[model samples]
Target: MIQRHEKQIERIHKWKEDHATLLKRIRKIYIWVIWLMLPVAIFFWLFLPLSRNTVMIWFWSYYALWQVWIISRSKTVMWTHVARFFAAGIWLVGPLCAGLLWSIHYLLADGAASIQEPWSAIILGPIVEEIFKLLPLLLFLFVTGKERQLSLTDYALFGFALGTGFQFMEEVLRSWVSSRESLLGMFISLIYDNTKEWGFAELFPGYFIHGDVIAAGHHVWTGFAALGIGFAVHFRQKLGKWIWLVPLFLLSWAIFDHGAYNSHVNLLTSDIIIEFLHFFTGYGHWYKWLFVLSLFLAVYLDYRTLNQEKKALPLLPHETLLEPVTESIELIKSILQSPKQWAATMLFLRERRAYGFAMALKEREKPRQKIYHHVQLAYHLLGISALLLLSFLAVNSIAVENPYYLAGLFDGLSAWWESLSAFEQISIILTTTLVTALLMLATGGGIISAGFTAIGTGLLAKDTLANSEQIASILRDPKSFFKQLQEDAKEMPPQELMMKLFGLGLDFASRRIPGGKEGIEWLSNLQSKSQQFGKKAKMDGDRGGGGREGNEGTGNIPKKTVTSNKGKTIDVTPTANHSTTTSVPNPAKGTPNSSVDILDKKTGEIKTRRFYGPDGRAVRDVDYTNHGNAKTHPEWPHEHIFKWNSDGTFNR
Candidate 1:
């Protein structure tokens, strides 16, 4: 049995190595593709007479990317990983799930018309779409082998990508179906047809109302579900066996929200609730408010989780320390004075973030090895591929009867190209070549030399050019830059610096905009209130014995107080023997709210840990000291678990 276990571990390790290699190669290829496609995307954006639908698509796409960027600013996950997942949502999950939905409707419904009927849209649609949208997240967790290492923000980002992709595809299909255009015609219309009929209402459907569009959408819904999944996985051990139900509950809630929107059912039936939502959202979009609220709550939870996780991460070497304002100023200076340095600085920052995340992951507890069968992986891949192929065929079969054929469209284009005079063709080629070359050079060269050449000839701002050389010097040496950043951080209080920057921004805005001074005053009051609230919360936490002390004991171990769910405080103190013991405030008869953590003397590694509930039962117990007892515990470093009852009690 031991030999078999060893073999399994060996296989798991081998698979992980191979998977890492494959991912690295894929990342390299993706980077190349992004660079190569940049010019093409720009050319199309500039020259194409985009239809209303296409414009809306571009708008939503930009909005989604912007949201991802803003939310992931302080996150541990790499943007590239999120981008790959986003692409998957667009190209893979979106089409495959869509095809599946089409197939289901065709199989069950009376005809093509029945697919959009009330019953299907209200009931069947929500279940199928929600489940399919979640599949990518589940698959990602299974395949990555670093599920435990992932943060809540990471899961949310993945879900957002999937949801965005699905939404885009849905909008495209709606346009195609409504217009009764041929596949080829639909493609052409997306680029060449200039139609003004499609407005914000048509693009977003039920979301736009009262001259405003709610930020909540399909991405928000999926992100909420994904955050629940993250919570369930992260707290499974601490929260007991019942914690796994969180994801299911969230998923069900998402389905209900989707169904309610489709059926035009107002879940918020109370007048008070309706009034509150309308006043805040500036519209009577109850479903959108519910989704937005849920997403916001989930984000708040993610932020809390991030606070805890960040404490475990070591500070990165040579990390940029400039405040947001200073950083922006430096970036602008780099772009204007030296584009090459700007490019290098950007690359350096990207690498630095990636390295920080890598270090954090390395510091985490070693994960349990799981044997992943190649056959099982192959089956999953084949199943997904088959579904995609079948869906494509099914959708194509439905569209084939349309009048606008792709063959004739391509033929016309070919003929047009052939008929062009040599001079015209040369001009066209030269224009395209020049545009592409200029774009490549501008982006590649760190700064557009032509644009700078023009700007350099004119009067430049003295303030902007004041520290140009200094910025250039720092950009050249990342180590020096980071070292200076650390010094700056040490010299100035972060809050003070933040306040100074905010004041500068407010002053600048007040001078330029109407009622800006009043807005600034209101914002200041809000900030003051928020700070007071934060201070109160911290004080409460400390009073309740939920805060850790900074004072270090022997071997740099810190004494801390932990507050349990039952309002019990447990004081933990490190001993001379390298073991820590938790002392409960008071014992109720036989019940004890105590715990013990045995640590290795040399490495300070946890050898064994045990936690007792208020009911005197062992709620959780980890045994790394008994790995030799394979008969009892086949898995090394396994924990003895207790089930949590619905009424806040544990069942052993």
Candidate 2:
């Protein structure tokens, strides 16, 4: 009897498990279906006037591209799909609120504002609209006990939906209250619009405002509210607690953004700057922009809170991606020698930067940065590998006719917008281009300045290279950039040191010499006291090629050696003349040891490249023996370790 009962129970459990699995799959399909039908919503809402040919073709093409993108294997593409729909759904609520606004405006205000009642349309409109929007959000906060997973972008969307609804109602009433002539004008326009449904601007007569404008406003107000709420919620969330009072400031910001927007009709302040901001952040009027900006702020807060929460959690060693750690030196040798430890150090530094920025931005803030961190790097590697594999198959070019369609459509729309007479497009493009050029110049200049430093350091190395490795090693150091200057420093003319370090000997210290700042800072810093530690430029006449026999004489020295983000290799470049032309005796000779940890160059180094590996670590060049000072590690990979060289050999 007992065995029979147990068997029955087991059978029931198995049935339930199977049923649950089936339900999950069904839900997934249902979600996909809803996601796929989004283009219909877009068409229905856009309400633009265009030829059927243009409308249908554009819509179909757009729909297909969106479909392919969402279903793509890339998580970046998939998440974007979800976000767009979320934005759309957010806008749909506008129609309903707009209906309410129409009822209020006509039933209460009767018709256009009288000469003495300008404030009625301005003040009343915002009051009613704001109530509609904020009430729902406040209600959610009150009932949910805590809104933990909510982001600033979500708030922006919510605000947008509220504004949209208000706009719809307001427009309906505006149309209803219109004169017969205007009504006739609208009807005739509708006929024309239906014939040429190109974009989403044809439904103005029957609606409050365009969906784009409406969505933008809603997004702004909500975004603003989110900023305040975000700040309030940040610390509470980090502590794993909740407080209803957190969103009060957010609510106030919404009020201000909306109230101010409604109050202003000024052309310069209201129409231009306000309108510009509204459009920039996806709002109808500039008044709404503060709200969207707020949303961006909220996103920032949300990420900060989440990061803090993550940090507060107790760490365990289970080999995970979300969290990782390197081994410690509790019972082991030195920390620097341990490969596992260095790996962890590099990983932490890389992750902090990537995820740090990831959570800081809202849903649509330039995804490429995050993509680079989480996936694009891998994709690039895969792309290269695939190229190599395809070459073996003798394929010259490959094109996947999937995601490019949407990109092309976007290109067209952007082009059309660019061609428009509106000042909005012109200002945006001009400002963007100027900013981009400036950034490019800054970055390019930074690189060139750095290059000059390396060359100067190499010059300094001319005298410093007791052996060839000093010259060769400089090329491999993180300071390889500065090493360029130091590379031949030891061999440079005495005058070159003044030229490189101070731009002049003791006479010229602070005269803002063109590229002298970099060379001076790097080499001069190398000197602890007042001693100048730079190289005087060595002319061809000052060449020092004392090919002294290396301690471990130059025998079969590998052509080139490449090191990556901490000796790890991402790629290996050819050694062909890349190494220093100089060589010297190894430690086997009397060459004094003068190596320092200056080459531990990579900071927040995420990925590493690989170069050619030669026979087991040989005395590739001279022996470096400078026991320089090391900085204390606050964000170290793990607990530190020590591995003293009992002999000259230790695990590198």
Candidate 3:
């Protein structure tokens, strides 16, 4: 075994040495990608919104090259790192972060509307984006077994790469969507489409919403803040537990800087900066200068930290090779080729540590990519609802001008509105909104993207109400909370737990609109009906010979019963609709000698028939049509002849 292991290790080394030429080619390709992308990016930036296709081409090309460059610079960059970073950024965090920030805008719209500058940029934007951005890094740490391994420099590099990817995608989205039309509005259009017949031209497309500015140095600042947190984490022992406070301060600074940049106003020393700049030159844009200054400072800090770390650890000769994995070297090869299969195996084995490690080995994300998935859902629902309102209004407007449209179900939209009860109106609004959104999703081309945006926007309201501050505090000591949840889950059956959750969801929805109590009550009633049906089904299974193996005579079938909400009960009896000789249900199997009287009341004639066998398949002759002397034991041609078969087959 030892000799075999040595041979495997030697073979691996030989393979690596042989692949040096290929590795060099790969490195050159990365370089080419970067150089090629720069020109296209610059061109797009110079000629803003020239076309959607051009902008997309530029952004993707730039992002791909930028990511490649970042990876190329690192000595220890691996295929795994490249795949994981891109997957986390492009697939997971990017869209979610955008959605989070968008939702915040709508949530705080009323308060923000009062402010001239973008309010979300200052408050909610920082919290949402920063936290969401941090999540990917944390996930990386957890998956890569780097929670303990990561140095401050590593943190800074990872943060920078991740933030760049996230920001680039965000820029692409902004370019694709119109500044004037919120994702919310786009979603609402679904409901409107039902009532109004607007041309395809009126619909907001990628072309109309262009010229989206991709902010420079924005992500660098955020990345720096993350790096500071990583530094704090690294030096927690020396900092005496108070190290955590450093991250908070750094994050706050990052947020303020972001807000200042986005709001286009200096948040810290606006008056002084403006005056100083104005004194030098009559033109004053203090925010732009401040943004530039902040970027410079963040970059400087990041560089200094990385330089110090590099000096301490030092890079390998090539400065870009993976550490030699031992023990399961063959397994590592398999994983590098097919990381997903390795992940599945780990999961199957219930090896948490191995699974996490394996997860970081490829381009895969956690199932819960966005913490604000529910928020997105809420936004989609809301957007659909708003559209429904607008569509109804448009329909009403048309009806007023030309009564032939509605034909009098409504005199106008107002008359129709006035006729509905509060509950009815709310029901119509929600149901119609949901239906419209689904229909739009099914039919529309760009609707999915719009829905994602709206859903992201919807998260704002939830985030505000939930309060990140409170959540942070709770998260610091989440043991008790998690324990409580675990206990609840253990105590409740899955079905009951699901019901409770559904009830809670309905409760949340009800709180949003007037007469929402009706919705909750309606849901409760539905649950009760469902439960009753379940009970009946269970009872049927219990009472009857439930399985094919249990063959009791067919005398145990339960009668159907219906009960109303008011306690009125109705019994239903089964009747034979087919032309077969059907037997009446009894408690037990029929005895061979037992006789039943077949009597015709109109003719006052009676004929007796003796049943034989468990199923009563064999019977003596009984013909009500004959006045007298009906054959007792009839042949095949007789009026009524039956024969029993042991195999449960019948013959007459």
Candidate 4:
């Protein structure tokens, strides 16, 4: 046996040596990867004609793909997957997107009242673009898993990402091909188009609203489509037949929205008599209300989405365990339960300095790369938002200081406005409102960026302070989470303490992942373990030492029944192992009683409490430790634990 043990140790040592050598080789390879990658990244972003916008286009394009990937996730996603998707998305998205731009050109020249690019871009682009953008998702869904539909949120996110990608490509191409002369020439052309048709305004807000509106429409249309598919797949008996109406509805919605937008012809145009025949009661101007209605309806849909997420949140798996886990799902569910309930809980827990749990849960939910990329996006958005806000401030400041340019702009534009003699008053008001809305959206970016920056910084700070390596490891190896839960939730372990730590990061979990109920099983186990461990300590002396006892001669009589032995003591979770030392409490407070009682009222032989050896086996002596620090409260100087080595390190 000794020879066998020696051989095993030798083999293990050899394996360690080999592993160390492998690690050295891996480091050497990393040096080469750095050399290879840096130049590639730089060149791809600089020298290549398309590379200037590559980061914007490819990054966001991949981001769009990632939305699909996450919703359609068969497994965990990683940076490698993101990179792969970027490469593939760019390859496929480029030509198709180019075609969209050309289609907008021809469609607008054919459909518009005047020859204009931006106006035509706005007028014909959206309707045509929606068709192209919706194709990839539709085909992807059909070929892969027809009936495995997405939730409305994911469907919306995916549609938006796709449209954003298309927009990115369009922007890149526009920037690439644009000339100063072209932009200058388009001013008159664009105005002509806008004068002829009002749809230009709808398309002009393409920076954000373009993707948003189309995503709204697609989300509604395709969302309905997916809902139908899901119904047919999952609950066939009731909804399968009803589901068929989705595509028809999709066609109807597109046609109606398109026709409604196309039907607008200003009263000054050649079609005014036809417009008067149709909209004699001012339907041309009233079309603005449709756009407003559409925007609000989209917002309402989003609200419903959030509420649906909330409803599903509480249903997340929790409490079906021996001890409750400290997953963020529970925390978020609690938050969503009611603003007041969560507010009180947050205040209570935060006041107690129990923030580690939230950090832990955040760490457990999001990995480093996801966090890094998200932070990058946030910073980019911050930059854009800040610029917009500053621009507005500048414009306002300029108006107050100079006044001449504002006068000139208002005069010139107002003259153009005055040209619409019959439509002057209503057009001015509508255009002004449109301008105001544009400013608001641009400025709103600042608000969104600030929100993200604040949340990210706070969460990151909490994670750092909380020592997130433990939780990070769990996220890295999800399969190990259950094992960690079991290990952390043992009776003699710091189950509750770990639970508190995990609780701090709950918000992070709330925003990410599905199936809160699945995650809470481990927490339930931890909770159960806490109760057992707490009960064990409470029942050490047969549960009789419920209150303070002053006498030196301890009562030997065992209790007749199990009872609550609640004491005014802070039982800490284990911090370090091996040393049987614990932090002490106030000497003024009564000592905790270690007693045991019979399980039932009808008892057998009297049971006595016994201490165990370091090996957790039978032993006689109950070891006492004395560890203390100068920071200890002066009033409780003598009560502080003082187990220290010669070096002054607290020997646990």
Candidate 5:
């Protein structure tokens, strides 16, 4: 019966795993579906004679459904999924508050509508929008209990969804409230009405003016930034305990970025920059470039926060790609090294887990592999960025040509739009949108192909050489590399011979120079004086008095001082608890030692001692906490060791 119960438990666990995998695949399918059907959404949303509000409502509803589907698959219970849907309803409440604020502002002001437009965009909009966007997040926090339970990525997505919903309604409200003609309609009208001798500048302005905010823009970016700040606050224990200033700093940055984007301050600030561009490139209105730059910064910062969180803890639902790599390395390390070395290495690996142990191992492997990894990262970054930039430049260049080829294309579009019936308009728009997306993709793919060809040729040549004798020179032969690895495992070593060369002359000069020795002596004296002060203070406190000049101690206090290397002095002080504390200097040549010692005063024996090197790293530690006088049994003594970067920062 017990065996049967165990089998049933195993079956349930297996079922859960299968269900999770199925959900992951389903989520991927849903994402792909959304992307593939985006052009369909764009076409219908633009061309259908349905009320703009209705179209927006449908769009939001579809997105909300996707969000609910995601939450359902989050390994949460049915009640949690249902709660998510209720939390999402808070976005509906947001716009109503925004509407109330707008109405109040309109009724209370004597300003013209033109004045109010910029005022609303710059001031009123960000305030109302950010406040309302935060409401759903606050509600999520209140409902979720401890904020630390949810991953930072999850909260970021929550804020993004909230901003998305608000952005949709806000955009619809803009379209509904505006008295001006639709941007696309005006552009089409301009093409037909001014068919003869049209000004390219007039056509350019229409393209810049848009009623709907794209999902990739300010709203989502700001929301992620704001939530990142909140994540830093709530996960301070995991992030960095007592670092309250970090979240406040992030919050300040988010508010400023949102305000700048909404107020079009990027454009305002770029006028001089644009004029400079005009002076050289003969075209300027660099506001879009500024906007894109700001968006990139926000996105990059959010990515950094997510990266830090990923380092601190495993991301939910998906294991880190490095986990398998690390385990594989450990399995290999175990096979290669002696049991003692293997144990030490395992301890070292655990200590450095937060610092990406797998990546570090790859770094220390064959020099060729390190080069390949670096080149791979560089090529990927350059290839993606350059490809996207070139594709967009190609598209935008064609659109904004001096003769206005895009305007001429719109002229043709006007004729087609007029010729088509309502149902036909939807079909044509869908086809055109898909064709445009395909063209852009094809252009990007072509550029990527050219880039990869060049990059591949160089990499292939490098790899060929790396596999042969050429890389031996870079890593200084295999024997030396293996020796270096062996030596690194033994202890926290000093600067390499080449690195020590620079400091060699300096140390020699310090030894020979008159003032250098005097300065060291002066620094040593200063340490002694500080110790004397501390002793006096201790005596005064013990006697319950407050006088710098205390009675001379013959038997009352014990004091001992040892100075070496004409460097910093280490004071070993005795306490009433029969313990002594001391600092040990580095005995290694060309390495300054900074260490402390604790001893059993009565035995005149070392109880515990920690040895630190020139880089201020505790290279070795010995604690006799459980040391026994009986020689019959041995104690398992150990030291927590660390490796250092070239610049003196410890690995973990």
Candidate 6:
């Protein structure tokens, strides 16, 4: 029965794995489809009136969002929350609050003029709009029950989305009424026009517009409040019972800023605040700078919190034996060299963050099924909405164009159609439809393949680039390079160092070396002679059998046994004064014996160590002698990595 139960559990686990694999495949296909459709949608949107304004807004908003995404260590924000909150801001919060405020104004005051009444715009409007803008996010937190799991950036992003959506709706309405040639043009004018003595300029300061009307306008206010909420939740332990006050204070401040702007009232005494800000910043926008400063502080706090959290989590498999500082430096170098590498590196970091989050969630006994479900639903909704929007725009563009032009084109086509028989017309229509569908499929497949190829090439290029410098150095001076390699071999495993050296030699030989192929032949012959000499010396000493003194003269090494992480014991032998060789017993049958070598050097009181792998192949190498004041004091270690090829050569 126990065996049966174990078998059943195994089957269940296998099924889950299969399900996960299928879901991953589906998600990839969905992402590819989205990418393919995005260009088409943008093309359609461009044909619509005021589309440039919408595009510009999206560009700036996403740019800011990207910055937030970068600053965040752990990406905890769900796409579902982003889409839902933004949509709610557009369809629910914006319209509902605006309509409610209008009703209140109509009841209290007279006509269109009452819309700008002090009670409405100055006090009530700010209070209503600010609270309503946050309602969707509050509801999201309550419904999802992810209040504790969320990062500060997640909250800020949600707030930014909500505010951006609300502002989008407001701007659309204003643009429709104002008879503006382009909203983008008007925005540019507001920024550049210093001569226009507009009352709205006082609210934003520096910019000749109202704060809430500009791009990232309402985003700044709402994001500030959301950040406070994030801080309060994250630091609940430190704040004790007063945690609620943090968000409340920030929310009140947002409302006050809105109200003050609307009323044209200066809360600060005289121009003291303005003058102080001007003296320091050379700009009189104290409010703007304060908000900016708060965002920076929030990012710093989030980074610190993430670092603290990471300390408790187990290291990733790749990170276990590798030095993180060294790995990061290599990653940065690769990123700088290639744009593809930059993208791949970012994706890798994102995956690592996801893994970290998964581990953290597991430790907390939290189920992520709901989050996954939400993400899928959001993606589907977004995909459907985008398709519908694009379809509508395509139709609308044609419909809104000059009827005569379209009619003339249609008449010509109609005449051509009339010239053909019914059978020919049917055949042509079918062929055109089939061809168009095939072209689209071909284009999409090509795009998806290209993306994958680019990613793979980027990773491959990074490895190639790793050895390029060393190969270049070897080409310049093989003798000096070989001498350095000999010194490194003393500290590193013999097999690993030899594989690296062999690989570098092959690369050097392939390049335009000083002595060409003859030089390589000479080097190979020299290595063979050295090996023969060592073997002869060993045989002579063994034949004499003169005990320890004879063994020492013959270079007989002293061996010590040490246990590996796998709980297997391996013999470590010092073959030379500077080098020690560690023999690793192969776990699998029919495999060659694997060994590692470590070289240690002592100078006066300071010691330097280099570690290598059991197979004499190193994924990374670190040198500690160069870091800090190594001559006077022991320095922090640095690493060098090499990729081992199946053909007994180092790839890097």
lDDT by residue (tens digit), candidate 5, 219-282: 3443444445444543344445334444333333333333333332222232243224223421
Candidate 4 lDDT by residue in tens digits, 1-652: 3345546755764464457668556644533443344455455445544344434443443343344433321111222222322222224544564455555445755522222222322223333443444555555444443122233333434444444444444443343333222454466445534321113224312221221122222223323333322222222333433444443344334323322233332212323333343244333232223333433333333222222222111111222111112323334445433222343333322211112222212223333344334334433543453343223221100011101010111213323444444543443343333222221111121211111111222222123223335456766897887775555443211212232344445544443556655555655566556545534433221212211112232322222222211222322221111111112222222123322111111111112222222333322221211112224422210112324345534332
Off by over 4 Å in 3: 1-75, 101-117, 177-216, 265-652
Clashes of each: 1, 88, 4, 48, 2, 13
lDDT by residue for model 3 over 91-206, one digit each (tens)?
Answer: 57766765554454457654323222233333444445655666677655444434344434445556655655555444433323322344665665444321211123421111
Error of 3 at 145 (Å): 3.7
Q: Judged by lDDT relative to the true structure, which candidate is superior, 1 or 5? A: 1
Candidate 3 local Cα displacement, residue 433, angstroms: 29
Ranking by lDDT: 1, 6, 3, 5, 4, 2
lDDT of each residue in 1-652, candidate 6, tens digit only: 3345546755764464457667557645644554455455445345543344444443444444445444443445434345446556667888778777767766876634455444555456666777778878766664555655666667777787677667645544442333322476466545632231113223221122333222125666777778776666566556563665667766665665554443332222223432342235323244455666766566545433433334332222222111223234434443434433443344444433343343333344324454344434433543453343223222101111101010111213334556656754444344333222222222212212111112322222223234457766766898997799767644433223443454445444445445544554554454455435434433221221111111122222234344432355544322222222122212222111222222221111112223334443434433323333436534333334566667666553
**Which of the predicted structures, 3 or 5, would earn the higher lDDT when compared with the native?**
3
Report the lDDT of model 3 for residue 569.
52
lDDT of each: 0.44, 0.31, 0.36, 0.32, 0.35, 0.44
List ranges where model 2 is wrong by over 4 Å: 1-120, 151-216, 235-300, 311-652
Candidate 1 residue 9 C-alpha distance from true site, Å:
18
Q: TM-scores for all candidates?
A: 0.44, 0.29, 0.30, 0.32, 0.30, 0.43
Winner on TM-score between 1 and 4 is 1
| Candidate 4: segments with Cα more than 4 A from true spot | 1-94, 97-128, 183-186, 189-237, 240-242, 255-652
For lDDT, candidate 1 versus 4, the one ahead is 1
lDDT for each residue of candidate 1 in 1-652, tens digit (9 for 90 to 100):
3446656865764464457667556644533544455455455545642333443563565356446545443334544455555556656776665566567666876645555444445445556666677787777666555455665566777777677666655554443344434577667556532232223333323132212313245666676677677666655556754665666656655554454333332222323432343345433354445544545554444334433332322111211121122223333433433433343334333323333344334444344342133224433543454344233222111111111111112213444556656754554454333332332222122112221111211112111222325545655897986687556444332322233333333333333566544654555454455435544443211211111211121122244444432345554432212213222212122224444454443222356566656666556655554333357655645556777677656554
lDDT of 1: 0.44
Q: Would you give me the overall lDDT of model 2?
A: 0.31
